[model samples]
Target: MKIAIIGTGNVGSALAQRFVQSGHQVSFGVRDASSPKSQKASTIAGTTLLSIEEASKLAEVIIIATPPEAVLSLVAQLGDVKNKIIIDTTNSIRTRPEPYATAYHALKEITKSNKIVKCFNSTGFENMNNPIYSDFGGIDMFCAGDNKEAKALAQNLAKQIGFSECWDFGGDDKVELLEKFALSWINLAIMQGHGRNLAFKVIKRA
Candidate 1:
């Protein structure tokens, strides 16, 4: 799988490393493609550091890890990713003291595209890279996309990264609900000081 990560930040870099270790060809794009972090990440992991155009062109799956403000710009530049699957990992956080990620506006932008999926935004990077949900084994991440096929593709990618459980939270419009869930998790973390040791489990009773 040829995967391109649009941002070289904590989330982007961490995801890139995990994907690479999973035997995928990973490429990372950044504002400063030659910066130390970008170069080091690419070199250490043996992945490619490319321009947005180059990366987008070569990738079958695009994982967007850019900030909320940059997502629109990044998508605009990506042109013609019509049939491709885009996994968005951004949070709409304000500058307030106890910030929460907003998704109403972001969901609006995503509803227009058939190629987008809202996922990997709720959990911290620690869980993103190495998630161990149950003693039985790790579970794949959760994802929601308007397009069923796109969601399936994202699920397959998750499995490649050692994730066996993938939760489908319905249409892409439900993406806002997932982002709101992240805020609840944050508030709990603040109150209990429970770093990233916790995870959500959905059980169905027969």
Candidate 2:
């Protein structure tokens, strides 16, 4: 999979490295290729750095790990991505894309693409770096989107990077709920005194 990560922050960097290590082509879409963040991310061997438009053009999937409000700008810079899959990894808990509830909502409205899946936003970046806990084996991931194939691709990508399972949180209507789920993680981990090491996992009794 040719993947374009639109941000070089903690979440973006982690996913880029993981996907590249998993044998996928990972490219970074940035405002300036020479920026410190971009340069630092480029050091992660096999990762390509290009303008937002360029990276989006060549990648099969584009992950938006940027601020929620950033979609307003990206909607124009992204060119035509109607045919590509977009995975939004932002939460509206902190700052939302005004008018739209979450980044996923913004992207869905702007791109009008059904291939938009909301995943990778419900946990801390540390967990994203490595979902596998030495004691627990591998933690679970979750996604929600109307497009079955798009959600399947996201689940496959999550599994490829060590997550035990990528549970389907539900379809598009459930996207905001997933964002709330992310806020719950944020509340428990950051606001409630628990450390970043904390993660969520479903337990089933049969």
Candidate 3:
């Protein structure tokens, strides 16, 4: 899989590294070609720095890792990605501690005809790199996309990166719910000392 990660933040870097390590071609999509993080990993053969358009053109799976506010503008710039599978890792929280637009609204507005699977937004960056499932526990990673094929592709990718319980929440309408889950997790991490070690586990007795 040729993967394009649009942002160079913790989530973006972590996902890029994981994908590269998993033997996939990685393009670190960034505004500046000479960014330190982009240059630091230049020695890796298949990892390259590319413009958003180049990344979009070359990669089958494009992960939008930009901050929430930038998502719409970025997608607009990327243009017609109809039928392409997009993994949205954006969260709707701004720097001022105020919530940005909801993921549902963002995705709906930005994605015209693209197949977007919303995942990697609900967990912390630390957990994203290496999510551990203890013997008695597992995390529920929610994904919702209108296209079934796209959702399945995203689910397979998620599982490849150590995510276990990939819950299909049905359609792109529920993207806001996933963002809310992340927001709630942020608050809990601050208050409950939960940090990245804790994740929601759904227990069903048979």
Candidate 4:
């Protein structure tokens, strides 16, 4: 997969490194390649740094790991994304794109693209860096979207990064619900001091 990560923050860099290690071609799309964050992400082997537009053009999949509000301005830079798959890994807990409830909503409406999915937002960057636990093996991931193909691709990417499963949260209406799920993790891991080493997994009895 030719993946373009739009941010170079903790979550973005973590996924980028894991994806690169999984043998996928990764590129970082940034406002300034020389910026500290972008420079740091560029240090990852087998990855390239390019302007936002350039990176978007070269990628088959575009992962938005930036702040939720950043998607408002990114609409213009994400040229011809109609044929590409967009995986939104943001939660609008602190700030959302105006006129839209979430970054996923903003991207779908502004870009008029149906191939969008909300994913990789339900846990901390530590989990994304390493989903495997000594006991549980691989933690589960969750994704929500209306497009079946888009959701399938998102689930595949999650597994490629060592997630055991990428459960389907639901259709478009469940996007916010998934964000709220992320908040639950934040509350436990940060507010309640449960520690970032924790993760969630679904259990079933056969």
How are the candidates ranked when ordered by TM-score, highest leading?
4, 2, 3, 1
Task: Arrange candidates by lDDT, descending.
Answer: 4, 2, 3, 1
Q: Write the per-residue lDDT of candidate 3 for residues 6-33, one digit (tens) a residue.
A: 8877888888777777788898777777
RMSD of each: 3.7, 1.0, 2.9, 0.6
- Best model number under TM-score: 4
Instruction: Give the higher-lDDT candidate: 3 or 4.
Output: 4
Native RMSD of candidate 1 (Å): 3.7
Q: Name the better of 2 and 4 by TM-score.
A: 4
Query: Model 1, range 95-178, lDDT digits (tens) per residue?
Result: 211222333245335435566777777667877778666684765477776878778887777767766677888785677677
Q: In model 3, which regions exceed 4 Å deviation?
A: 40-45, 95-100, 133-138
Q: What is the lDDT of residue 143 in candidate 1?
A: 78
Model 4 local distance difference test score: 0.95
Clashing pairs in 2: none
In candidate 1, which residue pairs get closer than 3 Å at backbone N, Cα or C atoms, i.e. clash?
A: 140-165
**TM values, all candidates:** 0.84, 0.97, 0.85, 0.99
- Whole-model lDDT per candidate: 0.71, 0.91, 0.73, 0.95
lDDT, model 2, position 9: 86
